[model samples]
Target: MTPDHEVLVIGAGFSGIGAALGLRRAGIDDFVILEERDDVGGSWYANTYPGVAVDISAFSYSFAAEPFASWSRVFPPGEELKAYADHCIDAYALRPHLRFNSRVKRASYSESAHVWTVVLGDGTALTARFVICATGWLTKPKTPAIAGLDTFKGDLVHTAQWDRSLDLDGKRVGVIGTGASAVQIVPEIAERTERLHVYQRTPTWLLPKPDFAVPESVRRLFRRVPATQRTIRLLTDVVTELSFVIAMVHYRRFPFLAKAGEAASKLYLRRQVKGDRTLMRKLTPSYRVGCKRPSLSKGYWRTFTRDHVELVTEPIEEITPSGIRTADGEEQDLDVLILATGFHVLDNLPPFPMRGQGGRDLKEFWKTERFQTYEGTSIKGYPNLWFIVGPYSFTGGSWFGMIDYQVTHALRVIGEARRRRATEAVVRPEKHDRSFRRNLRRMRNTVFLDPSCRGTHSYYLDEHGDAPAVRPASTYEAAWRARHFDLDDYSYER
Candidate 1:
């Protein structure tokens, strides 16, 4: 039996959008983009908390092929990103092909038919010759396992699912988790709230984000001469490569680089606190700079210095109806509670169920055998399946870089399969094993392996004591290998 479509892209996020564009550019269009949300933009669309913005520079965060020259700030806000996603969908005419509110329930592969049957939440099943899982790592928000959390009578919200209608003005608010989201949210709400208590389980490495409005002349220059924007992107990529990618990827060979980064961060924090050694110490991270994802902020540090804002370092005992009780038995009454506890990384990489090849479950395989993937895209037993953001797929850089490279890699294999009139394409077991081993070997030199990362509970490292979230290579390498990797690594069958 023939499949319903040639391909089925399982998200409408940047990754899925990239896959759709890749298929279109390869002169193939018989595909659909499935989204659980009511609209496009994925995380950017879902996350609209106050002061939300791209953590990285605006230029690097965007696609190279379609440069957005009219960003209002150096680190563009969440709304701009939402607008950008819409712009891409409109520009590529990807609307008709998108099925929003279509949540994938499970996907099963048929060995005999060499096709994938994707079951949606509403019980509708669609078949496709190939399936690309682009439901990214941030799809699932994680709520803390604090006791009595549900009993809290105050309005509660996760940073991922913010309700704009909920009011915080002149109300006592408690924010949990000092991860990326809290770094942005704390400053925005500190001044507005009657009293703000930032509960910090772990202090994240804070870097100075030089954020400012883009002058009209600069935007005009970028629009008039596209090369200028490209040049800025190039510079930003290089700086990111030097500062972050290199320090983490080659931490063993260049231990000082990570140390230097940490020292610089400490200095920045000290200066921000105006030599208030007590406040500086409270905000200092115990782990290496690159262990957990560090956050960039201009006001995150200053917000803590505000008289109305108090940083709570005590362990949270439980949530009372009035507020949160700490280990010391101190309870702070709150009118609102915000869980900025971040997302489930490895546990929700695919964000759904998948069965491939002779009733083999993908989640069970990973649970028993550890998370592994061929070039962070394909698995051996999962035929005709590609992950735009799979285990070990994210090389340290702007997410757009990872998306573009992975898209190119998947499209190349799909293009080759079509050229051969093949019914299925799967990575050879040996090639897949070799790639997995190579990743493990290279990861030994990275910061994740450093002793300081122990008990850090970084989302980067999975349960298997392996950092499967990172590709352990520079973005340039990822880009190059994506375009030039051996096609023979995959076994195409007619």
Candidate 2:
């Protein structure tokens, strides 16, 4: 790939590839995508743990622009989803523009030259007129700090970086952190392992996942009539958006619906646990269901029914060479250990050093107060730089929906910059503050910031104990804001 391009997309995942195509469609061809890994699928390629699948329906998970009517399941597995990412690259001919194994080290913009100088991990330099930070939110894995963790002699693994080559058959395995990954992985490994232990820090509300195979007849209809697929996706999109109300925004107002969801979750847990009251008590969550990101799974609950599987609720004190030790001084022997602890999404700082106007470091700017971005894409003093999945941009729908908004908005800004021959288009600080303040107002009364959740562990809350990950608004409003590019809100420097 060329070291210089008019546009530089900093990832080759769904968001990065989508941004590249979005730029291509805007008739801006001089661009390239830099992927840290050799493969294209960012999260999909990285997360290959057993039973890993999309929580959102496959129809909704897919890009509205690119429709693949032949999804195998309601929630496509990691392998299938990664293949879709592969399909997008091939269909859009983006492979030629991809630079694999190129991890970004830092980015510094020159106001006089009006160009961003991107420095690679190996000290390679590249210049681009515009930058799309599509580096995904959940890319950095977070492992817990357990005493004696390094002394563990048994096989160790992480869900994010699963070693598929390891054989777990007849092995005594212990899985840590009962979050999204643990739920999915436990079910897959239980039957294979001679004995399984699930360490739970905080229980999650697992609603029944509506998963089913696509019948041949339905597939034929989707293929014969492509619009039918669009119609189905549209309907699913509406259903997903409504969840923002029933589950996210106004759930407290509609307490019955929330209660209904919690009721369903309790019933599922009870039914699976049967007469095991102790297990049922351990599985039930005390905090509000919406406080944590709700998980969906039909298999996870039933997996505990296996006599060989045990759910350990005692807090882990340390990791022994033989196994994990609990606060009660009980140590379980394990032949293998897997850490399902999630990513460091709320690190509150850019992964790499970023310098903006007048050589101001982005990290230093946020350190004194907090991390902030305008419209979750543009930052004050950072001209011609955009983040597709930036802070406070997630709109409680499929990530495809969020990326669609941010990418289109970014390209529009670039188009405007080119049209005016403007050297830099930097967002005004007031505008950035205004948008951040709006999100702050929306944060009130949300389940994440609910006073009852003071002790709960959630990645949604940032370092300052504030929930600013998602914009509290409807999908329609988010789309309108995304498309309504206000040139007046930015300062154009020539």
Candidate 3:
């Protein structure tokens, strides 16, 4: 039973608490971390549903090593971002190097003891001369395979595994896939369901959450005004980088900002579903406003202007025993189906089990095509292995500024693996496979990789249409290229 550490960190969230506070400010206190779940708010402790907030903005989604300044709101739910990741694990004492429920399953990578063994899930093995996965990319939960979904039988849950003791008051729910956790659980189960339905397949581009609240004298003037909340998070990161350069280099002079965001989403869908024009053209979304990931809500359009909601864009075609069967043959009974269908962000490291170098297998190098790494945290053959918010590292803005720019390029690759007395480091396989195929062919010429754009298959591409998992820059140029860490793009191993 010999298990130690110098870094192991699997997933205490927020990129394993910024890779254990960047290896405890790089002094490297024999790390640990783990956390299958028992705390430390990873994915805000498995998403406790019901309008689980945070659409970025809590002083640019915190952590420059804790500067929340008491954010009451401006998009801050999920139990106040799981009490601000439990106040950054008690202001960085980090619970004696966490461990929580401990899961890990399988990690492997020895190449003659450069180390990383791992194991866990009751077998317990551990050993780490570096491993920092920070397992995120929306902590699992994808559900949806449909077809009698376990014989309907009612209560099915999924918005990232949320199931808070069931009971949606009058029940009758159903709510499947509208994305962004079904636009925050279909306006919070259309206010205690009794008839919700809400199916829909495509259609999202929401926007207009201008959220509020933060007063306690603006959280004591953003903690006694020191660069006043980093100059209002750098002027909301320069107006969200000039609105992603007006949706990628001035899309035809912003056709009146996409016709005023589609006439304010058709005037908030005719003030929330009055006379339901076929559920307002099935929540109209033919796509455009930044292609996808655009939801923000003032009660998700007044919970589809409830009268016990309805929405249903059809096309389910299964799940019988008493609900959800629409491929036109309609059915809809329900008692509670939920799903909200999201996570599995292009399979970013599902259930551990990596196995890099020669044995290859990062799920067969992402099914031999899509998932690349390079800047999304080094991969070529995964050496000391980092991956804070890995794989193209999604960023429309503020994923805590891309997990503090991948914890400052994984604390400068653990200070270049303690100045070259390194055990392993990799990431130089032809300069990380030609910088991940030149950033997936420069984001396949933008417009959300326009396959003639109409949108829907979320997780931003990877059934081999190849977008290689997000990050088309502009989050302050990916936190200024993850704050400078580029030993000529890696390759060490002494």
Query: Which candidate has the top score in lDDT?
Result: 1
- Work out the TM-score per prediction: 0.99, 0.96, 0.33
- Clashing pairs for model 1 are none
Off by over 4 Å in 2: 1-3, 244-246
lDDT of 1 by residue, 6-121 (tens): 99999998988888888878888899999999999899999999989999998999888889988999898999998999888988898999999999999999999999999999
Compared with the true structure, all predictions reach lDDT values of 0.91, 0.84, 0.75
In candidate 3, position 209 carries an lDDT of 77
**Which ranges in model 3 have alpha carbons more than 4 Å from their true place?**
1-102, 105-119, 140-155, 159-173, 176-179, 183-263, 266-293, 296-333, 339-387, 390-408, 411-415, 422-473, 479-494
Question: For all the candidates, what are their Cα RMSDs to the real structure?
Answer: 0.9, 1.9, 21.1
Write candidate 3's Cα lDDT for 1-494 as tens digits.
12378778898988788778777777788888999889887888888887788876677677755778877877778888888888877877989989889888878777777777888899988888778788887877778887779887878778788778888998788878887777877776676777887877887767667888877897898888857888887787666655543454344544466557668777876776675677677778776666665767776766776677877776888988778879889797888888878777666464677786666668677777557788887787768878777778766666777777877887787787778777777778787788777776667555666553544676766676766556666666667877764675787767
Full ranking by lDDT: 1, 2, 3
Residue by residue across 220-265, what tens digits does model 2's lDDT show? 9998998999898988888777654446765555666667778989
